[model samples]
Target: MGMTLVRSLFLIIHQKMSTSSSAILTPVGVRGMNVLDRAKFLRNIKIPVLKVADEKLSKITPICKQYFLKLENFKPVQSVSGEKLKCIHMNPEKIGAWTDLSEIDRKSLKEHSVNEDNFIMKDIELSYENWSYGTIFKAVLPENEDIVSGFTQVGHIIHLNLKDHLLQYRPLIGQVLVNKIKSCRTVVNKSSTIDNTYRNFNMEVIAGEENFLVTVKENLCNFTFDFSKVYWNSRLGQEHERILNFLKPGDVLFDVFCGVGPFAIPAVKKKCKVYANDLNPDSFKWLNHNAKTNKLNMALFKSYNLDGKDFILTVFKEYITNYCLGKEKLEKGAKIHVTMNLPAIAVEFLKCYKGLIEDEELLEKFDCEIIVYVYCFAAGTDVLAVAKSMVIDNIGCDISDNIIDIFDVRNVSPKKEMIRVGFKLGKEVIFSAKDCVSEPPKKKLCVDN
Candidate 1:
């Protein structure tokens, strides 16, 4: 029998029980009654089952027992002739069960006659078992499996990049994610791509609270930032830790585009002096807040809000001059490291390093080498070669193959990749005016903006 027809019959029986006063509810497979006899008895007798509201079930249990009706367990079934048989019990009533009726009962019920009004037809509410987000969404929207796979959770926020076709169902998908995911309290959809220098994408809240403040723990450090304003990629936890493992206690780190101090603050906690800066004022504000929250000494860390080029030329240059030159030369175990993480344009910022220390005498006297870790996006199969060439062109010097170390970070797209090119800045690249001078390239590489 079709499930729709069976459910319709179950509702009919439920309605009759609710309205009728004398309802003799009986199970289909009684001990003494055979399949044919049970079918005959059900067809001939007008058995009215009592339907008590779910909340009032406790009060009506005694009344169900007084009538000697089967009030223990109710299992709705189909007759041998493909007719749906309704069963009712008083202990705890459930409308339907998925079971097949015997062939004899199906035929007998078809031959027997019963009032149509006794079988009340109402809407059937299907119950669902709590399952995973993908499973539940698949059950509800089997056609849009990709939508379920596109969501990313950052802290307590569920971030989704829904396709244009799935925009109509954004609310439905977002609500389901919020309901299904225990850690998520708010859900937002990516409304626009990251096109600005701040590296922040436009987002619209589709479900739950409107708040975007979140606290994320990484590398044993707690970081709090406004998700809507600043840029934070929880996916980069491994990258953050990988870089941290390379640092020593006395290393000086200059983060050119330090969004909320993800790299800087952690370095500070490791007893490294950090000079962190960002173009976004919001990022700068939170960077200071996070530094203080982490209980880092103000003397060990300095935060700045300035353009990438200006920051390198000003704040970073000052650090090199003061701590890396003259009387305040770095100790034996100390080192200088610059982090340019704006993968899209960070390679171009390498130009600032040229003519960074203009004085030949000071450049020659500078015994410590400045290592730069420039993150950039490279296309094609030979990602390391592309990244190396880009770094060499921007720095205006031929970096030796032995010193340049390029690490493949991650694939940003099918044909594009994010790679980190690390090399030490020598006197020729920093002090020699001829080697430092170079014009911008005619064509630019494709990278995230």
Candidate 2:
């Protein structure tokens, strides 16, 4: 009876096996063999298998030694089989799979997942791009994606001009900027345009400290001022240095609108005499402070709080007269430079230079020429032409194209540009008795308080 049963099982397997499954099926000759031989044949035979659901397989896969099912072992079946299988076949390992992973690697796998969340999965390190404002707030506020890169830093303060759409996120953006910049301790957003003669705009603190007083270093000199009261542009550091490079020892500089002594103190440090004046009393006060702080002699550096036209007529005219009529004759290399930096109305002061030294004998006694650096705001496509016309029209004299050098300082807005038109004030332009204008042309007046 046992032999018959064994024979029947072999017949059933032989009938079910196909040419592809022949490799795994045992030879059908177990009916004539002994009971022990029949058992040995059954143990060596292989059978087709099917895979369980992935979730179910995962639960048992860790503990079992050979629970994996191979793709080749699976076949289409109309119904479930009753035969019990003791072993399973596995396919080749899939890509990125850890074939050597054991039940002991559970702790390591957990650590890898955590590291992925913290962005340290690889040896390469994360950079500023990973934590930039665009990356961190891109999903929450997509409109302010480019605002982070447009900030200006004044000493320890970060100045931002945020649009209306970004005003809601000002605090959050300011906090991120402070965190990113190591030296910044305060962040402020410009609340209004710079319309006042002092070139100061309203600002509100967004992060960190509330103080507006900042000390900035430029051209190796330190300047301290109240940012809310005076005008100070960190972007003009290069312009200050460029002007400084043109100075020599014993040279005299008249800064008509020297705010916080950005140009005057540095010039004094370079061994040049400076007559720095500003209409803003706050700027004049800080200019004195900065001059002293930079170890400049008060005798060589003079500070004045007077209107641009008044400063030229009083202190500046007196200085030129004394230099021309002094015992020591004016040196050939010595230069007199007048800087008018208030771009909105600085060009209007050019009329003040006409007949600045009325005494022809006193002007003729000096061998040096007066060089004027006048700044102006020009609009439209023809900025150079507009700037040239402004100087010629205000000075009431025809200036040669070769004598005037126009420098594009920067763009103030989409339609406006800041320009510096530097020219040598000819003897004819300064001392000519014809077309002499005592006062500048009528315009919006800037008064000293």
Error of 1 at 123 (Å): 19
lDDT of 1: 0.63
| lDDT score, candidate 1, position 142 | 23
The sequence of per-residue lDDT tens digits that candidate 1 reaches over residues 322-353 is 65456455657777888888887788878877
Tens digits of per-residue lDDT for model 2, 18-62? 222233222233222211121222223232232223334334335
Computed on alpha carbons, the lDDT of every model, listed in order, comes to: 0.63, 0.64
As a whole number from 0 to 100, the lDDT of residue 251 in candidate 1 is 84
Which pairs clash in model 1? 12-119, 12-120, 17-49, 23-48, 79-106, 80-105, 80-106, 80-107, 81-106, 81-107
State the number of backbone clashes in model 1: 10
Backbone clashes under 3 angstroms, per model? 10, 0
At residue 33, candidate 2 shows an lDDT of: 25
